[model samples]
Target: MRSSFARSGLLTAGLCAAVALSTPALAQDKIKVGLILTLSGPAAALGQQARAAFEMALKDLGGKLGGREVELVVADDELKPDVAVTKVKGLIDRDKVDVVVGPTFSNILGAIAKPVTDAKVFLISPNAGPSPLAGKGCSPFFFATSYQNDQVHQVSGKVAQSRGYKTLYLLAPNYQAGKDAIAGVKRDYKGQIVEESYVPLNTLDFQSELAKIAAAKPDAVFTFMPGGMGVNLIKQYKQAGLADRIPLLSSFTVDESTLPAQGDAALGMFAGSNWAPDLDNPQNKAFVAAYVAQQKAVPATYAFQAYDAALLLDGALKATGGKTDDKEALRAAFLKADFTSLRGAFKFSRNGFPVQDFYLTKVGKRPDGKLETQIVEKVFSDYVDSYLPECSIK
Candidate 1:
């Protein structure tokens, strides 16, 4: 009887040990997040800043979401759409990321939208919300933490019109975003366009465009060149001795990422966006402080958006209790837009694009004699995209 009782006690102890060993395996189930950014080439600065902020978000969130670990996978798109597509596919198939963030440029976003949506992977863009994605191509599984393509340009138009500029020369890259920028400016600026030029993508020479601007003799020049394009154009503009004579207004042309390289040339330049690094808000303050402490650099709009994207994903993960398989539930949770956004009072449009404030920022000298872009004024309060009418999302 004693031997039988001892065997029963041993078997019970073994069962308890088995359950204890299996519990950790259940706890080890993590939600995978895939981040695809243009981590190389001319846009490397934007991607690097984005990566920093995302890592910051992970750190702030204690590297977990809803008591579950989050596995983050990052990839570089090399500013190539084909490369972006392949990397996104690999993220979905191999990395098995439940959420996908970024491919900063609009061109890459366009290339990957179909595949990302078809795969039903939750795509939240840190930047690059092209018009089609915000309109006819709106997907339930996709959301944009950034504004629509034309948003900042529209704000620039408002700033230009407010400044009493009767005529403006507009320049942008020869791409979809370039066209959208021109269209956006026209929508807000009821002035004569003396000249409009779409320079070739990645064009280094702005002399020809500058000369044309000199001849057209517009009161001001508005441009939408981003990344290295903006750096090159701004330097040439300064070199041509046009910086002081003609005011430069832009969309994403002058920003934190490009401003240091621009030096004093960027000072006094006007650009517009939904976010600025010096925005006065609790969330913005916290994000900026953390970012500066970690990266030893000022955060840009791109960085803010990337950080917000991570927070947005975290909110959804929390809402669904970290279950990534129920995509519909996750999508619904994200649509609720429950996260604390750096862009104050943020919400999504019918098409999943951000409906938020737009501000005019002036590149000015900080107390430390460093060039920085600060918010001059708010242009649009809770602005909705013009393409929303085309979107049929209920």
Candidate 2:
């Protein structure tokens, strides 16, 4: 009888140990996230910041999600929607990723939103937030830490409108975001647009375009060209002396990453940026210090937003105990105001967009060894896009 009782106790111990072992393995398998970003091409420099933020987040969080170590798969979308779509499909069908992180461009965002959502996967857009996605057209599975495409430009337009800048010329790359930007500026600013030009993406030489702008003689020129194109345009604009005759106002296209390349040419130019390299807040300072320390590179708003998105996801994972496989649970956690990000604290609205800040920043050399985006004007402090009514989701 004593031997039998001892055997029974041993059996109970074995069963309990087996269950405990299985629990961790099961939790670890619950979350798998895939990253899609422009790791190359003209936007490659911008991608560097996003990549850095992601790596830091993983390291800081000990590679865990929801009490389980996250299984992360990263792919370079190369700024091509087709490439982005292929990578996303592979991640879902082959890798069985539970959630998809991003595709930076708004055009690319629009292309991939349906596929991931249709597959019952959440597509967390860290950067792209087009007006269409923010409006009655919004999707339940599509969430953005990034501000709406128009919100920043709307602020720019409002600034222009307030200043009574009547004669303006608009330039953008021939793409969805560019078109959306043009429309956004037009939405608020009632002014004489001398001409609207759509240049090819990544066109470095703008001598001819500058000549036309100089000839038209608009009071101001508003442009939407990101990455290399922004660098090239601003450089040539200075060379052509357009910066003296007409103040160049742009949005998102000329922040920290491109400003360094622009050098003295970017000085005194006004840009509508969500964050600057020299923001006074503790959150911005820490993020800038950490990024430069880790990657030996300055980060852009693109990187900042991406970093914010990861931090947001980390908070959600913890709230859900790493059980990201439950779509409803994960979504609820994301919606729950549990995140504390480098941008301070932010949360998604019912429609999956941010109530954030938009500032009109000026490019200038501060005392620091970096190009600074000084807040010359603020468009909105606690801003939510007016088009949130367009979102299909509650």
Candidate 3:
């Protein structure tokens, strides 16, 4: 039931077709790394981009790492927690991969955590940093190369506090991620949460939700609806004529991938993220140029982070003289502060999360009719999660 790299979009046919065609000496073999993501249904586009960027990184790595072939196994978790567990199980039990990367959603990440740990394989999370793992829920085998979910929103909430918005309305999907986002916002902003509403995870129709937000009459509304849900919410927010009425503050709902699809509706929306295509860093400029040249498009934050993850992994492999199948050795190599990512200098927390900057972005349109995200403010510089004290790494 496990699909190979070709069908999974992590490798081309030439690679899979050649899997059996390798010389006998090739039996010295490659270390297999499995990637599980929600590659279909509502969040398909997010998973697709994550997988695409990841494969492109391997391709950029010339299909090999540490002198050994790198084989990627991808599974679709369909954005469901239960499905994620099943997919991880299949990858570990059937494919016996040495390392794992990605499931994208924080909820899904929580689902796959135990199985991957029980199997004794390292799980490298390029996205999805739930707060629990940063605290007492921390796992030795789990490493998040991306920021914790609270990092960006905590920044956004603090922005609200600085602006002195007294009354704020909050909305998010009734899921683990949504609750975490609300808690993150609350952690920083000491404002009147005039109202808070939890909508179903798949509620694409938001007129009802919009009404509650409107009636709350709050100075601002904070939300964390990523993927397709964002597209629907922005469109409805515009249609409801709420765009100019009440300020909209968000985390992960507006980005390169979502901006274009959102078009004029997203113009001037308040957002925050760790990386934007418009960041003024030299590494970001190079990453944006190279990414556009490769894909003929803007790279999403997820793509940039995943792209960085690959380079980080590459740095780890090379540091250890390209010998990485050894799990403990690989973990040590990975924990070393060794690489410059597209986000510039990168390092991990003692508990395996990012300590990085967060930016406040405004959704604006370029003169050429293409929508773009422009930085508007700063939340925190070189911020680490407050829950680090609860982690057991030290």
lDDT of 2: 0.81
Candidates in order have lDDT scores of: 0.87, 0.81, 0.81
lDDT of 2 by residue, 134-214 (tens): 787677777888888887777677788889898889999998889888987888899998999999877888888999998
Which 10 consecutive positions of candidate 2 have the poorest summed lDDT? 337-346
Please report how far candidate 3 places residue 49 from its true position, in Å: 1.6
- Model 2 residue 42 CA deviation (Å) reads 1.2
Select the stronger candidate by TM-score from 2 and 3: 2
Which 10-residue span in candidate 1 carries the lowest summed lDDT?
Answer: 364-373
Please identify which of the two predictions, 1 or 3, would achieve the higher lDDT against the true structure: 1
Candidate number with greatest TM-score: 1
Backbone collision tally, model 2: 6
- Candidates' RMSD to native: 3.2, 3.6, 8.7
